[model samples]
Target: MRLNLRTIWKMIRELSGDDAYERYLKNFHKLHAHDEQHECDTPLSKAEFFKQWQDEKWQGIKRCC
Candidate 1:
């Protein structure tokens, strides 16, 4: 699946309705900051970043039928 900024923002908006989303965003920002630090200073690959975010944000959320 391909993800662009629009898709990401859509997901963020949807997830933001949850209380835990704030915590997830905080952790994600921390991870982004740490990634920005350090000597390597390499940016996260799109897939890697999205995978990490999905795990952090939606791992336990279940969809209702």
Candidate 2:
């Protein structure tokens, strides 16, 4: 058997919503990175982002069939 890392990463990103976080980070930096006094490169680290993501996810309807 061969391990398909690309496919595995895609599935993990979809399930964990990491791809969204990455997109958010990209947009955040693009809009805010110009500030010379910016205190941080990222508004939220992976841990904080994941916690908030989970909270928002379960706080309301996630999906419906």
Best prediction by lDDT: 2
Model 2 per-residue lDDT tens digits across residues 8-42: 98889978776877877887888887887867644
lDDT of 1 at 45: 57
lDDT of each: 0.61, 0.79
Stretches of candidate 1 above 4 Å error? 1-38, 59-65
TM-score to native of every candidate shown: 0.32, 0.51
Q: Residue 60 CA error for candidate 2 (Å)?
A: 1.9
Model 2 regions lying over 4 Å from their true place: 1-12, 34-42
Model 1, span 1-65: residue lDDT tens = 45688788777776664334455556656777756545544455556665676677676757887
